[model samples]
Target chain A: MSAEETVSQPNPIEQFELHRIFPLEINGIETSFTNASLFMLLAALGVVALMVLATSRQAIVPGRIQSLAEMLYEFVANMVRQTAGKEGMKFFPFVFSLFSFILIANLIGLVPYTYSVTSQIVVTFAFAALVLTLVVVYGVYRNGLGFLKLFVPHGVPLPVLVVLVPIEIISFLSRPISLSVRLFANILAGHITLAVFGGFVVLLLASNGWSFLAPVPLLAIVALYALELLVACLQAFVFSVLTCVYLNDAIHPGH
Target chain B: MKMTIISPAFAAESEQETHETVGATGGEAHHEGGFPPFQQENFAPQIVWLIGIFGILYLLMSRVALPRVGGILENRETKIASDLEASREMQAKAQAAARANEENIRLRREEAQAIGRDAQQKIANEAAAQRTRAETEAAEKIRAAEARISAAKTQALGNVEQIAIDAAASIIEKLSGAGVDKDRLVAEYRNVKSS
Candidate 1:
C-alpha cells in the first residue's frame, strides 16, 4: 500500500493547467503572459492569416481557401440577416470574430497539449458579455426605454404578466450566463474526458498485463476525440447563433 | 491482481525504477486536486492576452478580411448583374435593329411598287397619245387620197362625156354624111346626163 501510494497519479485534469510563459506586470497589475495567451494569439493569428491570405487574390472564381473564407463570411452574414434583419449586419464583424475565435481556440485545444481559450469560463464570459453589452447599447440607443418591452410577452393576460414578466426578465438576464456556460462547459467536459481517456491508456500500459487492454481505451480516445472535434465546432456555431438571436431582440424589441 | 500477470516480466522492474526516479520531474507537479483554471495567478495574463489577441483578431476581421471578402462578392454580383443588363440591352437593340431593317425593306418595297405603278401609268398615257397622233395622220392621209380620187373621177367622167358626145356625133355625121347641130347635141347630152 505504501509502495502503491508512492506511485505518481495519471492526472488527467492537469492538461488544463495554465503555466506562466512570460511574467508580466503593468502599473501594479499582474498581467503575466501564459500558455492560454499563446494559444489565443495563435488562434487569432491563424484566423487572420486564413482570412487575409484566402481573400488576397479576390478572384472572380474562388479557389478552395477563398471559398472557405467566403463561405464563413456568408454564413454569418446570412445568420445575422435571418435573425436580426439587415440592420443587424452592422454587428457582423464582432459576431464573426467571436465565432472564429471560439472555433479556432476549440480546434487548437484538440491538439495533443494545447490550451483551449474558449474552455476558460472567463474567456467565454468575456465574449458573452461583449455580446450582451452590444445588445443593451444598441437596444437602448435605438429604442430608448421601449427596449424594456422585450420582457412583456404578447397575447397573454395582463394579470399573468404580473407573474410571467419577472420570469421573462430572469430568462433575458440569464442569456449571458447560459451562453457562456454552454460553450465553456462543452469544451471543458470534452477536453477533460479526452484527457482522462488518454490517461487511462497510460495507466493501462504502465501496469503489468493491463497493457493488452490499453487498445480499448485508445479506441475510445479516438472516438471521443472525434466527438470532441464535433462538439468544438458545434459549440462555436451555437455561440454565434445565440449571439445573433440575442441581437435580434435588440433590433426588434417587442417580440 | 491484474498487474502480476504481465508476460514481459524482465522489463517491468526497469520501467518501474525509471518511473520512480523521474516521477517527481513529470507527474507530481500536475496532479494536485485543486482546479488548475481557478488559480488566481493565471487570470490577469490570460485577460491581457485575450484582449490583445482578440482585439487584433477583431481588427483583422472587421477592417481587412471582411471588407475584402465583401468587396469581392459585391463586385462579382454587380458585374454579373451589369453583364446581364448589358446582354439584355444588346438583345433588345438587336431586335430593334432587325425590326428597323424589316421596316426599311418594307418601305423600299412599297416605294419600288409605287415607282413601278407610276412608270406603268406614264407609259400607258404616252402610248395613248402616240396612238391618237398616228390615227390622226392616217385619217388625214385617207381624206387627201379620197379627195384626189374624187377629182380624178370628175376629170375622167368629163372626158368620157365629151368622148361619148363626139363618138355619137361622128357616128351620126358619118351615117348621114351631114354636119350635126351643136345645140341639139348639147341638149340631148344634157337630157341624157340629167336622166
Candidate 2:
C-alpha cells in the first residue's frame, strides 16, 4: 500500500490549486497575481473585445459580430427590465457586467488547463456581496427605512408576523450566501466531477485487464463535459437573474 | 483498482505539502495543508483581481459600449417608422389621384350624353319645320291649277253655243239665198237650248 501511494496518484483536486505567477503587494496585503487573476483578465478582455471592438462600425444593419453583441445587450437589458422593472434599468450596467464576466469566465474555464475563476468561493462571494450591498444601499437610499417592509407582510395577522418576519429576515440575510455558493458550487462541482472521471480513464488505461473498459469512463467524461458546458452558461444566467430579482425587491420593497 | 478508490483524500494531503512548501517560499508563507479552495492564503488575490477587473468592465460597459448599441437600435426603429409613414403617404396620394381620374371620367360621360340629346332635339325640330313648309307649298299650287281649269271650261261652253247658232243661220241662207239676223238667231238658239 505504501509503495503504491508513492506512484502516480490520480489527483483531480490538484487542478484547482493556484500558483502565483507574479507576487504582488499592495500596501501590505498579498495580492499576488495568480492563474485566477489571469483568467479574470482574460474574461474582462473578452468582454471588451466583444462589446467595444465588435461594435466599432455601428452599422444600421448589423453583421454577425455586431448582431451577436447587440443580441447580448438586448438579452441582458430585457432581463433587467422584466425582473427589475423599468426603474431597475438603473442597475443595468452592474448586472450586465456580472452576467458577462461570469459567463466568459465559466466558458473559458471549461477549456482544458485554464482556471475557472468563478469556482473560487471568494470571487463568487465578492460578486454576491456586491449585489447584496447594492440592493441594501439603493433600497435604503431610495425608499428609506420603508425598505424594511420587505420583511413585514402587508395583510398578515400579528401572530403570523411574529413567525413570518424572522423567516423573511433570515431568507433575506442568506441571499448572499446562497447566491455566491450556488455559482461557486455548481462550477466547482462540475469541474471536479469532470476531473475525477478523466482520472478514471487514465487509471483504467494504465491497468492491464481493464484497459479495454476505459472507453466507458471516457464516454462518461464526454457526457459530463456537455453537462458542465450547460451549467456554465446556466449558472451565469441564474446569477444575473437572481441579481435582478433582488434589485427588484430593493426597488419596490412592499412585497 | 484500490489505488483509484483511495487516492483523492490521500493525494490531497500530499499535494497540500508540496503546495505549502512552495507557498512558504512564495509570499503566502502562512499556508495550511488541506483542500486548495478552503485554504486561506489564496483568497485575497482572487478577490482583488475580481474587484479590479470587474470594476473596469463595469466602467467600459456603462460609458461606451451600451450607448453605441442603444443608439444603433434607436436609429433602426426611427428609420422603419419613417419609411412606413412615407409609404402611407404615397398610398394616400395614389388613392386621391385615382379618385380624381374617376371623377374626370364621370364628368366627360355626362357631357357626351347632354351633347347627343341636344343634337337629337335639333334634328327633330328641323324635320318638323321642313314638312310643314313643303305641305303648304303643294297646297297653293293645287289651288291655282284648279282655278285655271274652271275658267277654261266656262269659256269653251260659251263658244260652243255661239258656233251652233251660226251654223244654223248659214244652212238657211245657203238653202234659200237669204241673210239671217245674228242676234235673232242667237236669241232663238238660246230659247231652244233653254227649252
Candidate 3:
C-alpha cells in the first residue's frame, strides 16, 4: 500500500516547475532565464514568423498562409474598431501582439510536456498591468481630468452616485487582478486537470486487476484536452476583447 | 492530499507559505516545493522576459509586419476600383460604337432607297421618249406612202383616156372600111370626157 501510494502520488503540479536555463543577475535582480522565458520567446517568434514571412510575397491574390495572416489581422482589426471605435485603431499593434502572444502561448501549452507561459500569474499580471497602465496614461493624456468621468456614468440620479461611483471604482481597481487571474487560473486549471486525468491512467495501470480502467481516464483526458483547447482560444479572445473594452472607456468615457 | 492536488484553487492557498519558505532556502529545495507557480523567486525573471519579449514583438508587429499587410490590402482595393472603372468605360464606349453603327446603317438604307427611286423615274422617262420618237417616224412613213400611191393613180387615169379613143377609132375603121384621123378622134374624145 505504501509503495502504491508513493508510485501514484498525484504529481500534476510538478509540470509547472520552472528550471533556470541560464542564471543571470541583472543589477542584483534575479532575472534568471527560465522555461517561461523560452516559451515566451517561442510565442513571440511564432507571431513574427507568421506575420512577417507569410506576407513576404504580398500577393494580390493571397496564398493560404497569407490568408491566415490577413484573417487574423482583420479579425483583431474589426474587433478593435467595433469595441473601441475608429480612433481606437492607434492601439492596433499593441492589441494584436497581446492577442497573438496569449493565443500562441495557450496553444503551445496545450502540447504535451510544453510549459505554458500564460499559466504564470506574474506573466499574465504583467500583461494586465501593461494594458491598465496604457489606459490610465492615455486616458489622462488625451481626456485630462475628464478621464475620471469613466467612473461617473452619465444620467444617473445624484443619490445613486454615492453607491454607483464607489462600485465603479472598485470594479476599475479590480480589472487587473481579474484580467490576470482569469487567464492564469484558466490555463493553470486546464493543465492541472489534464495532468490529474493523466495521473489516473497511470495510477490505474499500476494497480493489479484495475488496469482495464486505465482506458476510461485516458478517454476522459482526450475529451478534456479538446475542451481545454477551446478554453485556451476562448481565454485569449476574452482577454483581448476586455482589453479593447477598457481602451474604449479611455477613448469615449462617461457614457 | 489527492483532493487538494486535484483542486488547484485549494492547493494554491494551502501551499503558498510552504513554497515561499522553500523559495527562500532555494537551490535543491525547489523540486520538493509546494505549487511551483506560487513560488516567489520565479516572478522577476518571468516579468523581465515578458516585458523584453513583448516589447520586441510589439516593435516587430507595429514597425514591420503590419504595414506590409495594410499595403497589400490597400493595393488590392485600389486595383479593384481601377478595374471596375476601366470596365465601365469600355462598356460605354462599346455602346457608343453600336449606336454609331446603327445610325450609319439607317443612313445607308435611306440613300439606297433614294438611288433606286431616281433610277426608276429615269427609266420610265427614257421609255416614254423612245416610244414617242418611234410613233412619229412610223406616221410620217405611212403618209409618204399614201402620197406616192395617189400620184401613180392620177398618171394611169390620164393614159386610160388616150388608149380608149384609139380603140374606138380602130373599130370604126374596120366596120366602114375607111381611114380615120387620130387628131380629130382625140378632139372628139376630149369633148366627150369633158361632157
Candidate whose lDDT is highest = 3
Ranking of models by lDDT: 3, 2, 1
How do the residues B1-195 of candidate 3 rate in per-residue lDDT, one tens digit apiece? 122334443342243233333322131222354457677788899998889999999999999999998889889999999999999999999999999999999999999999999999999999999999999999899889888888887878777766776787888898887999988988877798899
On lDDT, who's better, 1 or 3? 3
Winner of 2 and 3 under DockQ: 2
DockQ of each: 0.28, 0.41, 0.38
Q: What's the ranking of the predictions by DockQ, best on top? A: 2, 3, 1
**What are the clashing pairs of model 2?**
none
Candidate 2 lDDT, tens digit per residue, A186-245? 887787777767766777788889889999989998898899899999999999999999
Please give me the DockQ of candidate 1 compared with the native complex. 0.28
Candidate 2 chain A has its poorest 10 consecutive residues by lDDT at: A1-10
Tell me the tens digit of each residue's lDDT in model 1 across A87-193: 88999998899988888889988887677888777788888898899899999999999899999976889999999999999998999998988887788767766
Off by over 4 Å in 2: A1-8, B1-32, B120-195
Residue A120, candidate 2: alpha-carbon lDDT:
78
Fnat across every predicted model, in order? 0.71, 0.73, 0.75
Per residue, candidate 3 scores C-alpha lDDT tens digits across A132-195 of: 9999999999999999999999999999999999999999999999898889878877887788
TM agreement with the true structure for every prediction: 0.71, 0.82, 0.79
Best by TM-score: 2
